[model samples]
Target: MTPPPEDLASEDAKIPAPASPDALRDAILSVAAGDADSFAGLYDATSARVHGLVLRVLRDPAQAEEVTQEVYLEVFRRAAGFDPARGSALAWILTLAHRRAVDRVRSSQSQSDRDVAYESRANTQEPDPTGEAALATLEAQRVRTALEQLSERQAEAIRLAYLDGLTQTQVADRLGIPLGTAKTRLRDGLLALRRIVSAPRQRKEE
Candidate 1:
């Protein structure tokens, strides 16, 4: 069976020490042409420095190790894109390592920010029993104040029809009044309630 592509760099990975700048550049160019032996030589020449740079930026040994493997794989794939005329081969490799490490840091931070925002929204939207009770108390006060302005029969009709959930005909029967008279009392009571509710706001605006 054929070994994995990563094993290609594993063969002579630790066989040789570091190479000179020109020799490393030559090896990188050879690896660009599909030379597995030269890639192993290139890995031997720069893997330590690349791993160290990644470790320093990431600050986690396990994550650094994972990123180091990714950097070498990137080097294997992008060796052909290197331009010696622009810079040395080691400089190109270190650039790849640093960029990968910083990207991981940024991705982790972004995920953390999203988690915090979701938690904040969840807490804000949760129902509050105290606040709901306070709102109900304020509404009851408004209804009581509006009823004071209505006639006794009108107030009684509205309470039976709306607050007690009675039908209009039932309100008329309970009060011993006609259906039309009950409807007229409910309508007048509602108009008076609207006027009383709006009075506070209109006064504030004026």
Candidate 2:
């Protein structure tokens, strides 16, 4: 596996010995008190073990690296609530890493399942030409209405680029405007169109 970044690595030369449990606990306490140096030391000393556990659960180097960073961020945010009576500092940190890794795995699986289900439905559904034509007409009407909401210059830019199938450069040439101005019009027009089109759906959802 690829090693972590240099800045994240422990500065072993600075300390003659490995981090003791007492030292880790002290670091956590200091971290809770907003000591930046203590937080850095804690991360350096414990990151390897934390990352290893997360990587084992995730089984993907890139994802493990991301989750390890997230785990440390959570540790920093919630450090003030660490309870020595309930558990050791290392155990607490490890638990956070494990939980975050598992959550990532579950979230990935859920998204995959949703994609599979959508594909299955799309494949099995029968085509209805009449209904499809009606739907397409309604969609086109909606889009035209949305286009009407934009300024004439913005609307002209969108139609030239999208409906006329012109590149931004071509659109600029056709409109006799600078390429940057053409891009700005297209961007603003699309944003306004999206808001206009989605307003009805937003109201229904609410």
Q: Which candidate wins on TM-score?
A: 2
**Which lDDT tens digits does candidate 1 get at residues 109-189?**
977996898787876564456785799689778877878888898789768865665666677899998876775676556
Weakest lDDT window of 10 consecutive positions for candidate 1: 1-10
Question: How far in Å is the alpha carbon of 10 misplaced in model 1?
Answer: 27
lDDT (Cα atoms) of all candidates against the true structure: 0.71, 0.72
Q: What's the lDDT for residue 72 in model 2?
A: 67
Q: Clashing pairs in model 1?
A: none
Tell me each candidate's RMSD, in Å, in order: 32.5, 16.4
TM-score of 1: 0.50
- Give lDDT: candidate 1, residue 201: 66
Tens digit of per-residue lDDT, candidate 2, span 135-202? 96886688677788899999998777655556667788998999778857765665566556667867
Which pairs clash inside model 2?
Answer: none
